[model samples]
Target: MTLLQDPANKNRYKVNLVPAANGLNVRTQIPFYSPWRVFFFADNAADLAETMLLYNLNEPCKIENTEWIKPVNYVGIWWEMHLGISTWAMTERHGATTENMKAYIDFAANHGIDAVLAEGWNKGWENWGEKDAFSFTEAYPDFKLKELAEYADEKGVMIIGHHETGGDIELYERQLDSAFALYQSLGIHHVKTGYAGPTPDGEHKHGQFMVNHYNLVMQKAAEYEISLDVHEPVMFSGLCRTYPNLMTGEGVRGMEWNAWSEGNMPSHTCIIPFTRGMAGPIDYTPGIFDIDLSAHKEDREKWNSEDRGNTAVHATLANQLALMVVLYSPMQMAADLIENYEGHEAFSFIENMPATWDESIYLDAEIGEYIVVARRSGTTWYVAAITNEEKRDIAFIANFLNEGKTYIARMLYDSPESHYENNPEDYQILETEAQQLDGFNLKLAPGGGAIIVFEPD
Candidate 1:
């Protein structure tokens, strides 16, 4: 789908669907039907965030007994590769070796995280981006898939499987059942699938061909009771309601962009909840303790030409922490090296944060400027607020807290000396007693944010 603005009329626009030309575009015999074109109306960002039009438009749950469909907080051998501290392809610094996987699994288990994702455990990174170069069911020489899976299970953690098809849908389609069966047999219920390159038939990711393919994969995954977290995927349109196993997707500009490029503007996250977030859950993979790639500079220069050394997370450390609450994803990733998180005081927030929420409230928002949201799991309430590049002051009202109950609010916010560009790591943690309807004012540094966890006192 392409949107073109009129040259003569500034206010006019045109929407066009590019032809697939692949004969499979549309081949209905009787009265053909098109997918629903949706338009949403909202009086405020809160309303926008709370809208369920997309889910309501889709069909009801098709998979009965969704007992296996569960939310997970995961750590992975993913971000290290992006930082150039390790390589995806097997090498001296290969990130997905059995030892690395076991270490990550141990970290997740110790931290109360639910799962560990091993991206390079499978054979294919050596030929990444090449069609048919990946064997989804085959393990790399250094990665003992079955052994690691068993170890994770022993440690009370699940392995989030990875399948990088390099955008060769044909190859992935052929191996879908076998690949899913392999994980299912090993008791791995969650899978993160990637399509990083061009499709075999020049198909657009959002085009009909890929849309059908995505749906097919989702349905097939259900056969093996494997949930999916798809990257380089088509925009989510509330399919999770019908297929609850369609856990989360990476259709928006996500964290990895920060590693190799100028990274997302501070406002990028501030605006997502009102836009991309309304569609469904997003796997934004938050929680980066290392704001700048200072520690990995030499390694990045040697391993990844894409890392020019000028790029960083482009937000304060507190902003990364706050995103765990701001962004909604059932399968959330604590996306940093285990070494970075080890013994870090702020890492406590990520460790205690819940991936599944019982309820949510969009407290306040201004599109692309700032947003404040609160979510509740059991009796605890987690609130997150983020801003654009400009520093601003905001107030948090505890009216959402349980009535007549006293609570303790632990706030992690950007320090007065903090700035996204200069001192991104400076942050302060404060704890205070709070009563229902109580309020407090916070100072958010430029490109910064805050997270407050309220527990009943």
Candidate 2:
């Protein structure tokens, strides 16, 4: 029997490594995110997970009849805040304006992005820290909701509504129907909802009460045909299977942390797939072109001050690119400013990659160390490999590829000089030809990754 099935040692293994220190900020414990993540080789793993999600997963399952929502590859108006350049309100610090949003819409028109997310478009952001501070239906004067939707619709782009409740669940529920109505009237079907703080004092995030709260929101939201992309959310527990409208949620340490905090360790990404990912799709919001923060160093320091650690991505450009495939999100974001990406060669991979996969295989995985995933969409296959703080060598055969068909392998990889802390931006791009029988070797740098796209030759 394998370690997971061998009923020999329960108390010996603590099930999780992240201590209470990691979760004090979120007002929850990390032990709950572990426990049932050790098994994956079995043929009925998903069925086993479904049984667990209903019982020990600690999340309430309120299944309803709803059609599956298609995945979207999107962009947003969020980089300015992460860079510490602007705030969300309408003051001089405000970053999202009509002209700027239109520029984003124009950019989305040409690129493959499906939606443009506008946070702080509503009026209540000034009181974002105050409980019950936001009005769900009201828009800031500068952000013309009517005209903005028209502009996006004309450009063949969709607008993703934003609702930052700031932990006021009561107030959010009060306005839910009307707010969703407003979005529906404007042709907006997807929205990002956030609860940045803990539920009223003395309450925790994953408690049964709060779990039901999330389910109520998803159930109510489905009536208006709106899909929810949640931030500052409870850990995933496979709720998407029952409510397909609950598309993706940001429940882990993500790219934004790299801007303000000590930043997520490279191993954090490798560790999460085995832990929290047992739940569902994560809106980790990957894809940042400026791995080297030189262009925005001043802004980052101004905004973060002493809290900012390295203020740089711990991975090469190719590593960031590989995350698009490795981090599975039906709703993925090209999370960088448009201008920075105009001339970059790696942007094409993000552009061409499909939002959903037909089949996926975990070529290899080791908790907190490294993982490799190969996904197929239509006739092409995409492979991504990533490692933690340590660099490692990897070699795999293409036996998964179809036999007798030659394929062009477009690869984006880390350079020899690439090191997460030393030189995060170093990378090289190449195209090659290979067959099902051929094997390839990859050297993942410290905090680095590799991506390969195979198209029939």
Candidate 3:
């Protein structure tokens, strides 16, 4: 009459005795409760993070014959709808017309963004309640698709297609091949698929069937050499190891929530890297210069009430910029309207950061409180740190740098006059020389963040 128990309190491994219906006591066991965690006794925070990635990841899963697998730093037409600046339909406020798209293409090309995403380029966006409301191949009258495609090709920018099917998987599956063929012919190798609203497959979005459905879409996308970024997706659990082209996902409370609904708490990003982010990379769409939410007053009043009532993203402008590094999305989006980014020096950070990284180090982290990360793209290293609603001050030892090497640290962070609730936009820039033996200190405002880049001199 013995029951198996955990041998030690600190170890995560556990087991229990199981009795069969026939009263047989078997030596069956349970796995570790903390399956995703691996503790390491390393030299520093950077060492711990690098080791963690190595512990969990398999080989890079690039598909065969997929030539020119490009990185996905993108600019897109998503934030306008949330901000009430534009609608997807063919109306006065519509933002995805040919003229407007061409302007965005120019902006992206000038800023080093690799792809452009237009949400309502196709017809049937206004009729979601009806069956087959998404037509991926047919364009609206004002959205000159072929011309825009040619322009993007000439500019050396890829055009990312959008397909929001209102959860009508049947119709989406039926149109899948033709839609993919259209994109392939036009030289587009990526698509952002959305499954908003309920699933018609009589299953919850996370149900086995829906997960299988999402997998089927990725498998098919690979056939056409098209990578996928799915919204309203199943939680990522090493799916990238199986499908290398499965880039970013929108499964958690994202930046747009601040526009229309009660925005995500400041702790959201700090928490996700261990929760939702542990499953896969997230397309959180982080760039927004207008924290006040007063830009579209009439729309805010008419739709969500002028009270605004804690609808802000609850972070400083620097925090938004820092998210590009802390949130590890290969398919990253500078998701704000192009005009909002004008003349902003912080925009330069977004422009300079690359979509892929050769190595990453989770420098310091506390779940739902704060996090610090460092990553190397090429010869340069970028560091980003973010805090929760509470104010925090952090200290970093530059021992992560190579020994005896001198580097310049370029920082963008909240100023002394800034607070996420009181003065969200105030930021200061600093440039200084540092070495691996030196130390750095950071002061974070309530719901604030910081970005530091180290380049060898």
Candidate 4:
């Protein structure tokens, strides 16, 4: 018998979804305008339960045709600081060359990455305080813009255009036409724009100014059929459902500033699940394989007189991996350098990570103390459980799996023998055949974590 399952809400209205050729044919008796939230995941997993809880409001909003809606499956590969594609490159460690740029693009293609966020490749902020930044339509003389876009398109890689303004609203508005024209010429479908500056009139731009601008761009992009990934903007307000093209927005601090500043710690990421992030989807780009906390310490010491505290916690890397499941972003970014993942086994999880989930669950979490998140893409389930600076041993019941099916679970975590100096090969991988009755115990170190990938045998 063909099996079908609908969202189970024993006490209230439920959405009945029938499997269709493309997706789920959804049907719900609830009113169309009923205040509701629909969580999207790539598959079925334990995490889906949590997602339903976090977004499920008091109102009655029913699913119309589940079969019509499919999970989003696009992973965003951020190629700005990591890959030297534009002059706005932050680290200056990498160079901007066609070969180097293509390497990252190829990395994405090889690793099953679906989308590429070419940040800092647009016009503006080329010279931190020196000259104008490079434009997409214009060639860099070293690399041809059109060629790069064509190459990416040919390789089945969707290029996500980026626009970062250092708080220059006038510049953005004035050059809006040219900006759109540039992306259009290059066949870019999605754009990730950001504004980093002092709030106008002493109010946060992300609150009002940036939010208004975000909607404006969304409106304009809708006319052009372009998608949006806003950064340093307003918190999510269920705009994805309304403007399906507005994939995600980044308001919280992400991994980038973490490398230089001390903003994003395990505690900070943990706090987001219930605070600022509670409102909507956060492009709080996760996934940092390399926790080189000692990096730039000399510079920090010589240039400034503050302790450049080490951030490469034993568990933070695992926490990042777990974030792939915890956070809901259509344009998700694995915010780490490619070389950091080279030859590492855990990188497999990062490579296979899906942009959206078919179902997601917040799991157990206590704001800033710790969090457990699970997400499903298909029949397979990916779980990421993480704690803050404090370490703890936890267990997750595998009741979300198919009851009778034998499933294999692969695990990765920080090894007891590994430290900051010898952390490269500290990961241990284990496999176990489990049923719904099995519960997995994970011993995570201080600032450490555990990652599990489950598949039916």
Candidate 5:
């Protein structure tokens, strides 16, 4: 769906449907009606962030039993491949071996993380970008799916099943039921579906064909009481509120881009809460302790030909930490390697952070510049703020705190020397006491961010 500006009228804009091989072909009965062209209005960015108009517009929950649908805070073996330390294909340096997944599962069980996602556990990753190259129900020899699932269950952690279709919709559709049934038999409740390559029939990723395909998969997943985190998916249209099992999706340029290309700018995340965030929850995959690729530099050069040796995350360490609160995803990922997080002081924040929230408040925002948000879970409140490339001082009153109640605020923010390019890892943690109406001031470095967790004192 392309937004085109009017050539004749300077102030007018229109939505255009780009034609693909399938074109805009839809045959319906005589009484058919087109979908709604929604337009939302708000007095300010904060008002826009809090609006539930989209959820209201969507249908009510269709499933009778909603208790099975729950939020997932997961760790994964995904980042290593993106960082060039490992390969997705079944090579000597493959990332998704049984031993590696078991280690991740053990880490999740110990760290309060809910599940573990193993992306390359299945076969056909070697033939990525080719049609009909992947089998949803098959696994590589190195990855023993049944054994890993049993180990994860014993550790009290769940395995997030992966089904990368290589954009072969027909192949996925044929094996969809059998694949879901396999996962169900293994007691796996969540799956992350990927469509990394072009559709075989040349349908646009956002075209009607893919849209209907996604809907069909979601409906089938619901039948088996499974949740999904979809990547390369259609823009969310508030169907999550209805299906609920459509937990979160990746419709934005996520953290993986930092590993491969010139990373997302500081302003990119600042703009998301008001734009892409309005659609629904996002799988932005936050919490990277290693701001620069220092640990993997040598290994990356040895293993990955695609590594240009220049790509690194363009945000302060605090900026990555703050994203857990600023960006919402029910299936949130601590998207760094386990070794990067082990024995790290900053890891405490992610270890204790909650993926599901009871309430969220937009404190302040200026689109593409900066944003501040506060979310509450049970009695604790977590506030996160992020800035663009320019350093600035942000001050706000904590009137949202419970009246007359003393609380402890644990703040993690960029240090005075912190810069995204020069010293992205420089940050400081502070603890202070606060109450209702207390004024707080924060100095954010260029391409930096801050996170504050408030607990009852």
Candidate 6:
């Protein structure tokens, strides 16, 4: 096993002290024993805020700290729109065979992705109207769980499995052994469990059934050495510190809402950083680099066929790449289709993101309008600065980089010379070196953004 340690061998990645008006933003960091290199953050010396200590891989990667801090750190992507369809469904769209799953896997592997989360691959959603959600084992008969696991393993990719129990806590508890057996037998490590809708007869489960269920799963998962990615049930309360495998959970209407409902307005993405995201870690998989706003397909209707106008493609790409630092999901999702990334230069920005961070800093921001965030995974650093519907020509201070430490900055932002409007895939990528207090004036179009990565000189 490759154990991580700082130059002093303290196993600590960073320790910083930033003075604020109310108090100091004191952050100390350390490494976790897992695929993603994670470093938790806190306000009061690691006591008030929780810290995630990873032992084995049972739960998804987690945002160990997000307490007054609106923007946290994460970099990941999702495979399905919701718990609605399997990769096979995409093949079915073209009358292709399920074997195409390999192609999807290859696409993800070729990209610099941390993990691939396949939703709706379970067996409960079909009978959701009957309160019988989904099941992973029975839904995709062609899904040889073992082979899928091996295939992902061979490709150096991790699988984030989904298990939608449909709030049948009693049944899930009863069949715990069988469920555990299936995952264990298949060498699966991470699971995205779901619980939507009201409890039976108003009896209810736990006051924090969502949180409690996650805790319960963590206990069981620890026994089997697995990780968890929960959805729709609990609010994040920093259990991730106690249960490192608990990567992230969902509690808001994500990109899927855009496909199906008019309520999920284009502005909704900018709204989350302050509202639902404030509670803690949200699996609000952001990075939909493609805002076709005009593409049509059979699944489009299934998603409710809402109008998503051209919101500046570059803005979307900027947000997706910036999400690595702006949003917080250790096991975060890229949340876009494979074809959407094809031939897009900014896709390289996505492929280069590190899911876990050794250090992070919430540079600056105004809730709902815009935010700037910076995160570091070792010698490497990433920064994302984004704005809402308005266009911006803002200046950025390279204060986060080490002084005297020469570094290369790869940046993608809007330019006046380009004919494309908010076209993220078409934006010019530039490399520059920073050795002192340097600055860059980024001009973003309406619904546009800027994404930059820095590596040690």
RMSD of each: 1.7, 6.2, 6.3, 11.0, 1.6, 12.2
Q: Estimate each model's TM-score.
A: 0.96, 0.86, 0.87, 0.76, 0.97, 0.74
Residue-by-residue lDDT tens digits, candidate 5, 1-457: 5567999997788987655565565545788877656777888887788888887888899999988888989999899988878888999899999889989998999898999999888888888777678888889998999999899999999899998888888999999999999999999989999988777566787667778899999999999989999998888889998999999999899999888877899999988877788889999998887888887678873344545668888899999999988999999999999999998999999999997999999898888888889999999999999999999788888888999899999999999999988999999999999998999998999999999999999
Per-model CA lDDT versus the true structure: 0.88, 0.79, 0.80, 0.61, 0.89, 0.58
lDDT at 351, model 4: 71
> Which rank order by lDDT, best down to worst?
5, 1, 3, 2, 4, 6
For model 4 the TM-score comes to 0.76
Q: Which stretches of candidate 3 lie over 4 Å from their true place?
A: 1-62, 298-310
What is the C-alpha lDDT profile of model 4 across 89-205, one tens digit per residue?
433532344666577678778877776655544433344432233343444445456777888888877767777666666556667777778777777767778766644433444
Model 2 CA deviation exceeding 4 Å by range: 1-68, 299-301, 304-306
Clashing pairs in 2: none
Off by over 4 Å in 6: 1-98, 131-133, 203-211, 263-271, 293-299, 303-315, 417-426
Candidate 2 lDDT for residue 233 = 83
Write the number of the candidate with greater lDDT, choosing between 3 and 5.
5
lDDT of 1 by residue, 293-331 (tens): 775667663455665668899899999988888999999
Number of clashing residue pairs in every model? 0, 0, 1, 32, 0, 27
Model 3 clash pairs are: 236-279
Give the 10-residue window scoring lowest on summed lDDT in candidate 1. Answer: 18-27
Candidate 1 vs candidate 2: which has greater TM-score?
1
Using lDDT as the yardstick, the better of models 4 and 6 is 4
Question: CA lDDT of 335 in candidate 3?
Answer: 82
Mark the regions of model 5 whose C-alpha exceeds 4 Å error after superposition: 18-22, 302-307
